[model samples]
Target: MKLKTLILAITFLATFNLFAQNTYVFLGSYNRDKTAEAIQVYQLDTLKGKLSKVTSAKDIINPSYLTLSPNGKYLYACTDTKTPNAGSVSSFEFNPENKSLTFLNKQSSGGENPVYVSIHKSGKWLVNANYTEGSVSVHPLLENGKIDSLAQNFQYMDGSTNKERQTRSHVHSAVFSPQNDYLFLPDLGVDKIRCYQFDENKKQPLVETKSPFTKTDLEAGPRHFTFHPNQKFGYCIEEMAGAISVYQYENGTLNKIQRIYTHPDKIKSGFESSDIHISPDGKFLYATNRGKENNIAIFSIDENGLLKNIGYQSTLGKHPRIFAIDESGKFLIATNVLTGNVVVFKRDQKTGMLKKTENKVKMENVSCVQIKRI
Candidate 1:
């Protein structure tokens, strides 16, 4: 009887490995006209690399960035962007059963050009980074998937060395640390990453950490950040420098470890690093280059969390702004903002390479892409 039970368990494990999980892809775009399908949802056929349109939410102006709640029930996006003093974060209720996103409500983003949004792992806290005005907005999340009014707006006062770009604070992204006990705001205008301790129980959850911020190289212009799966290392992609800064992450502190260029040629002219993400298995890191390069730089992570440049994959589209790897690490989808093309690529798990597949779709101003397994 023991032999039979052992064989049954082995058989079950093999069956599970043969089937991948159901994946849903979420897309956000720039809709300055407030029409033409601003946000969309698609179901990914993992085996074939096919993307089927599930739903589209329209009339939300400039839903350029998006984040999902921890529970996967709430979807939030930056709306009314690029307009002075009118930016807002809108919320939607995601119905996985029907693959639909129902519009919920919106709250003021507290500044202009709200470009990025991030939510805490607990699903109780949400934050937005206003780019043009250089501020951070904090909001509370209700149990019913509604976003509460703005609780705090932290504004930056100074800039960095670049006269053309850094004359004023431009907060590009707000991301929570791996442990969710800290929040980090990357200031492109200041060339510094501001840190703050967070306590969800407090009326205002964001407060200055012992180390208030980490200064990046002058004119680095940090845009996006991501943490490793082991929770011991973090990466910040600097737009202006076209490089990534590695850090040793502990508690609320980040100690710089190494800086590496994303491109091999070290070209100076027209390249901006836009987004960064680690594979679900933490074996590889990828960053999108938006300007003239328009490619995704791939790096292999060592045992100690240092990165070694491995290869570069052309996005097969122009202005590759954001790309997301599926939870299975078998598929990667990249969105090109200028060409409005969303291309799907099959990922080689062993070598960390991406090959373009025939599966592709076009949406006007498609700027962000995210994939999650359900």
Candidate 2:
């Protein structure tokens, strides 16, 4: 009887180990005006937070922005033609068994230069930011996970104070609040962060108490903003000034608390900011500086949610447009748009610093990185 019990215990342990080891990473790519280039898919191992290529050079248009469904069974990407005139988004059915993606369908984004895409928390709405048209649009997701025609669209009229880049309102990113109660849209052209209350029951969004939303410093040109996991603080990456502004947020209103330059003192040069992300632990914040300076600015968040400069790390490539921390917070992947390389970095959890890793993924004009678990 003792021998039989030992064998059954061993079998149960093996099954438990197998069930605990399931996870993956999905990468989205842009074609960069070339044919025969397809969206690349990679399998991310959860145990080590390492990425391995699963699908090579398959044909999918510009997969600019990628977001997974709340249920983790689907992936969606914004496919732009790379021209000012053509833009669309596509949905894919993700297969965990094969580590592959199957295209579902495509829908027009209702404006030119659709650069960013996001899904509502309720999984009922998909929002797009039309850069050239300076507008934001909402699409209803059908029961099958495909996007329908535009349900609502809004265009900004007041242009930015800066003429070169902000001659018109450029809607850059739209994101839903963690509670699914409000939607925040950051516009580069008008230098405004618009807030809207989303009614999941009615399938519509209403402007919040602030309505047209809050404005940053004139001509600050907010490109991206990220809310702290606690939802008490927010950070905005300003493209025009290459600075980050910290804000105290409560009940859908943002009160500016501090602003600081991403670049170190005496390094006076032109640089554009791309993305901002808060660490999973809510203890650190990171913002990417593209253009002349290709580095990431790091900051530490105090108990009060104020930001203090930690340091900066070179991405080891050009145009670090987007980057993401692995689900485990063990690794970070920075996409270099100009150099066409994705540089991997290991995270120092204690000091919130990133050290270059030996693993690097090479591709052409890579725009963004998204990771998931199977």
Highest TM-score scorer: 1
Tell me the RMSD of model 2 versus the true structure: 3.4
What tens digits encode model 1's per-residue C-alpha lDDT throughout 1-374?
99999999999998896563467899998877765788999999988899999898987888878888876778999998877568999999988787688999999999998999998888888899999989999999889888899899988879999999999999999888877889988899999999999998898999887799999999999999998999999999999999999999999899999999998675776888999998889999999887778999999999899999999999988998888988788999999989999999999999999999999999888978878776
RMSD (Å) per prediction = 2.5, 3.4
Total clashes in model 2, counting residue pairs 3 or more apart in sequence or in different chains: 4
Residue lDDT tens for model 2, 1-374: 99999999999999988775555555556775436455667766544546687764345677777788877777878787465688887788877677667778878887877778888777888888888888888888887888888778887777877878888888888877778778788888888898888776775564546555888898788888888899888888988888898889877778998999888786666788889888889888889998778999999999888889989999999999889877667777789988988877888888999988777778887878777655
Regions more than 4 Å wrong, model 2: 1-21, 46-49, 56-58, 206-210
**Residue-pair clashes per candidate:** 0, 4
- Compute the lDDT of residue 314 as modeled in candidate 1: 93
* Candidate 1 stretches greater than 4 Å from native: 1-21
Count clashing pairs, candidate 1: 0
